[model samples]
Every structure is written in structure tokens, then in C-alpha cells.
Target: MAARDYGQYSGITRAMELVGERWALLIVRDLLVGPRRYGELGAGLPRIPSNILAARLKELQAAGIIRRAPRSRVIVYELTPYGRELEPVVLALGAWGFKALDEPREEQIITPDSMTMDLRTAFRPLVAAGLPATAYAARFGVAELLIRVEGGELDVSRGDGEADLAFAAGPDIRRLISGQLAPERAISTGVVEVLRGRGELLTRFASTFHIAA
Candidate 1:
């Protein structure tokens, strides 16, 4: 059973009952990236209290949104098929929330999983289909990602690699993604520092991954 009841029969209410708790959707967000051990989940969400993490995991398991399975001889939590259905929903929610993001508070930290999803959310597949295949080694705060775009597909993974462009940005990369900051301006102002590759590819990156403000 869900942990709470609102005495309403609406689907929205039921969904809220299942995942509306603080940090519950964030757990789902990370799992959407891939399976994670309990410790890994905790590490990804360093702000969540350990007890709350344990309780949320139990509630999610009970609700059948996630399950534990043996992976490489270690148990990890992964989304069930039904839970995977939330991917588009989570992506849409991320896009909707993008407009509200300003600057990151000092306590906020970016994680690879979160950045992966953010790229997925902002990917313009049709636009990318017309562009040359591109690879980017990007850093947002401490998180490093290798991003590749070919045709209408995007692949993002942790760590660095050879790339057409390499750059580092803080949370202000949102400005570039939202088209509020042009590539030239971003580089000139130090909002993004080019570590390697041609600076012009940053324009392609901006065009390929954008969310209109």
C-alpha cells in the first residue's frame, strides 16, 4: 500500500502517493540512468538521510516501481518495466523545471547520472540528425561526461575521452542550453572554458542540445 492516502480516486493523486515524498522522484531519476547499489544511491544523493533512503527504497520496492537483482554478484536496485515508463515523464519534468533554475547554491552538487538525464531532456534529435556527428568531453562542476551525438541519437557516459570539443562550466551552462548565452559570449565571458577542440563546435553543441526559454 502507499504510505499515504488522499481519499481521492484520481491517478495523479495515486502517483503523488507513490512518489511525491521528498527525494523519491530523485531516486527514480537516478535509477532511470541505470541500476545502482544501495550505497551508490546514497552516494548519488548525499543529502538524503540514510534512514529516509532505506525507507524510500522499501516503499518503492513495495510499490513495484523498483526491484533488487543480482548484478555481478552484488545486489542492485533497478527500475521495473512499469517504472521505466516514467522516463518520458521525468524528462518532461526536468525540461519544465529548467526555466526556474538560476544559479546553484553552494551546497548543490551535480552528479553524472543527473547530467546524463539533463542532456537527454534537452537533446533535439531532429536538429541533430542534420548536423555532423560530434563528441564532447564536458565537465559541470565535478561531474565529467563524454557526450556523443550522431543522427538523432545521443549517448552520454561518465568520464572523459577524445572529443571534438572539451569544456567546463558550472551551473550556468543552463544559460547556454537555454539559448540565452551564445557560444562566443559564453567562452568570452568565461562561463565556459574550452579545454580542447575547436571553439566553433560549441555552437553545434548549443544547437544540438537546447531548451527554449
Candidate 2:
């Protein structure tokens, strides 16, 4: 498909000319988290047609927003530094769109990238202050993330392994982080779990992330 030239005078229009196509910004959103193989991208966006995804990747690469790089033995799609500058734009848009999130219907699905990004946006250093270093394994059925918080800092990485705490990622995670749900209640209900001596880590984890939405 030929790129749409929305005239060069209007910056927003020109910007849209680069990312206005359906699923274009979403592709950017996924790449913001980290590099992904074609299959990983497909798993994150189940509804996007494979052909359309291919086309968008080619378009983005041409736009200098993303690049193909060889990682290990596979080629992975990653955002350029210029592309990564879109982080605030995407996150601000997400924060603005939060109010529009209606109650979940039967058809709604939350992608792992979205979940991880939400965690990124919701992290609050003040809340994490004075907390001991801790590691958590967050499992969300199809995805697993390792989150480490220490010295009022948070780091999240792909893959799951041993950690101070292990918890299932669900609707309750948001609620817990938001203080809408009590930590004990979440644990009692099996919505969260922790190692034998690491129960306090769960509460600390919940406190460290605050999602106002």
C-alpha cells in the first residue's frame, strides 16, 4: 500500500500519515516493551492479519521507526531510539483512554505487553521507598514476567524463574495495586501467592505500583 501524504503543513496529520493506518500504533506499542520475533508479535496481537502485520513492519522500517536485527539465530523486530521516543505519547494516550475503559465483556482480552506496560506506567517510587529488595514472578497464563524492585526502583524482564514471590496475574492485580482490594484478601482467595517467609513481599509489591485508573 502507498503511504498517505496528508500534506506536510500539519504536523499531526503528517504524523498520522506515518502511523494512521489501523494497527500501526498498536504495533509500536508492542515493540516499546522489547524486541519481538514475528511469532511473538502475532501472539500479542491475535486479531491482526499476518499479511497486514508484515506490511506494517515493512512500512515502519521504511519510516525509520523500527529496524530488523539478528538476535541469536532469529531476526527480531525492534524499535529504533527515535521510535522509543514514542513512549510518553503511547503512555499518555493510555492514561487518557483509561477513563473510557468500560466493564469487561466476554470478548475482552488483555495482552501481556499491555499488562507489562501498565505496570511500567503505574510504578511509584515513593510507595516503594524503604522496602527491601524483592523479586516477583508474575504469571499471566500465556506470559510470565520477572519483576524486581529495590532501592525505590523497578525492573521488569521477560521469562519466569525463581523469585521471592509468585502470583497469578488477573483482574485482581490491578485492583490490588490500586488499593481497591486488600492484600490479605487477594492472597486468601488465591489471587496472589508468596514463598513461605516472603508474605510481606506481596503487600510491598502491591504498594509499589499504583494505577489510578
Candidate 3:
């Protein structure tokens, strides 16, 4: 049984009952990045109450959205096939919410999994298809990412690597992706720092990864 019952019979209602809790969908979001151990999930969502995390895990498992599996002799939580189907829905939601995003609160923190999903949400495959293959090493706050675009495919992962462009930005990177800040303007205003590689590629990066805000 789910934690809430709306006394309605509908798909959206059922989904809300299953994953509408404060932290449930966030748990699913992180798991979408990859399998995570119990502690890893906790680390990713630093603000979640331990009891709430435990409860949500149990609820998600009961709803058939996730499962416990052994990897390297250690238990990890991963999305079930049914749960993986939520990827598109999550990405769409991220894009929708991005338009309203403002400055980060002092307590708000960026995690690698969250950044990875954000990139996935903003990736414009059609635009990238018209451009040459490019790689970008980016650091946002404490999270570092290596982003590669080849044709219509976008791949993002943690860590630094050789790339055509390297830059660091805080939350203001949103300004660039939203097209509110041109590459040159962003650089001059200190919204983004080009550490290596061609600075002009920041323009390409903006075009490749964008959300119309």
C-alpha cells in the first residue's frame, strides 16, 4: 500500500502516490545516474533525513520502482526496468523547472549525479548533430564533469580530462545555457572562466547544451 490515497483511479494519481513524497523522486533521480549503495544515496542527498531515506527506499522497492542487488559483494540500489522508464519524465520535468530557477540558496549544494542529469536534460541533440565533435571539461562549484558531444550523442561523466574547452562556473552557468549571457559577455563578467582550450568553444558549448528560458 502506498503512503497516500487520493481515492481516484488514474495513472498520474498512482504515480504521485508512489513517488510524490518529498524525497522519493529525488532518490529516483540519483539512482537514474547509476546504482548506489545505501551510504552513497545518503551522501548524494545530504539533507534527507535518515529515517525518511530508509522509508522511501522501502516504499520504492515495494512499488517495484527499484530493487536491491549485489555488486562486488556489496548491496546496491538500482532502478527497475519500470523505474528506468521515468527517465524521460524526469528530464522533461527538469527542463520545465529550470526556467524558474533563481540563485542558489546558501544551503543548496550541487552533487555530481544532479549535475549529470542537468546536462542530460539540457542537451540539444538536434543542434549538436550539426556541429563537430567537441569535448568540454567543466567544474561547477565542487562538482567536476567531462562532457562530450559527438553527432547527436551527449555523454557526461565525472572527473577532468583533456578537452577542446575547459571552464569553471558556479550556478551562473545557467545564464549561459539559457542564452542570457553570450560567451564573451559571460567571460568578461566573470560568470565563466575559460581555463584551457579555445575560449570560443564556450559559444559552441552553449548552443549544444541549452534550455529556452
Candidate 4:
């Protein structure tokens, strides 16, 4: 580490304060795909300065969000299980940031979490442990969707046609699911668009999601 004049924040405050910087989220985003060597993470995030990267990684380690292990002769930075648990939040942030960016015509191929894949991953954690959906369907458009239940997992897609529950939330599914915006409030405010679903089924599906505090 260089002899830079860093501010005197307390250990925990310092850790949170470090990640509070601009490029810190991007550093974690690189790690979310999997582990990476320092250079690889640097390359993936072009805008981050090398020194800043090192500093953030150090802070993340200090905070117990990441750790490095030896591979071959070099060490690799990987998220701790504690850090990996933040993947949903990271994905949510990515989606939200993309929406705030410039026009849709840019054709930038950045995908945070796939709607189809989210369905699969979300169910694996809660409902369907092993098997794939017995029946699956989706109606893809500007806002893609997938409703599926595999093995024993059941999730309704947020598209047209019959759904046990429909989510017509425009742009911010994460906010709604994360409980930042109450589901009923979102529906009432016209922020999220929901479709048909029985009360029992809605309760069952809500159990599967991981909402943020």
C-alpha cells in the first residue's frame, strides 16, 4: 500500500466509507460473476484506478466482505459467502443504474440478472430444490418474463396471459421485492403492474424472495 493520506475513519466506518465511493460497486460487480485475480478485476472495470481498486479491496477484506486465497503463485480476490449474499442487491443496483443511463439505442450489452435465470435461481433457494419446471411459459417483449415451476417450485411470470400473480412494475422490480416500496403501495401508485393471483399463492411466492432491509 502507498503512503497516501487517507482519512481517519473507525475500522467499521472506514470500511463502509471506502465502499461508499463511486467505483466500489463496480469492483464487487466484477467479483459477482466469479472470483478473479487483481489484474482481471482491474481489466473488467476500466474506469477504476489501480490504486483505488487496491484500496477498496483492502477495505472490503477489512469489513469481512471479501477474502483472498492463493492460487498457483498469486492470490485471488473472491467474495465471502457473506459478500455473495449481496448478489441480489448488486444485481438490483445494476438494473437500476442501467435505467438511469442514456437512451436505449446505445446497444450496450450489459445484463445484470436475467428474468428467466432469476426465476430459476430464486426457486432453487426456496421452493424447487432439484427438478425443473413441470410446465413453463413466458411472453417476451420490452419487459421479458418467465413463469415456471420445476421439481416442486412454482413461480408466475410477469407477462400477459393467466398468472397466479402478475408483476407489472415498470423498471424497478428490485425496489418492490426488496420492500423499499410496499407491494400494495406500488400497485396503487402504478409503479408496479401486477396481474391475477390468489391470496394463498401470493403468500407462498413472497416467501421465496429475499427482501432487503
Each candidate's lDDT (Cα)? 0.94, 0.80, 0.93, 0.56
Model 3 TM-score on a 0 to 1 scale: 0.97
Return the top candidate by lDDT: 1
Clashes of 4: 8
Better of 1 and 4 by lDDT: 1
Could you tell me how far off, in angstroms, the CA of residue 28 lies in candidate 1 after the best superposition? 0.6
Candidate 4 Cα lDDT to native? 0.56
Question: Which residue pairs show collisions in model 4?
Answer: 132-150, 133-149, 133-150, 164-197, 166-195, 168-193, 169-192, 169-193
TM-score of each: 0.98, 0.85, 0.97, 0.44
lDDT of 1: 0.94
| Model 2 TM-score (2 dp) | 0.85
For residues 54-146, write the lDDT of model 2, one tens digit per residue: 999999888889999999999999999989988999887876665455556666677779777877777887767677888888876566788
- Which lDDT value does model 4 have at 202? 35
Determine the C-alpha RMSD for candidate 4 after optimal superposition of all C-alphas: 9.2
Off by over 4 Å in 3: none
lDDT measured at residue 153 in model 3 versus the true structure, 0 to 100: 99
Which regions of candidate 2 deviate over 4 angstroms? 1-8, 193-197
- Ranking according to lDDT, highest score first: 1, 3, 2, 4
Predicted candidate 3 versus true structure: per-residue lDDT over 1-213, tens digit per residue:
457899899999999999998899899999999999999999999989999999999999999999999999999999999999999999999999999999888888788999999999999999999999999999999999999999899888889998999999988888999998998999999999999998999999999889989
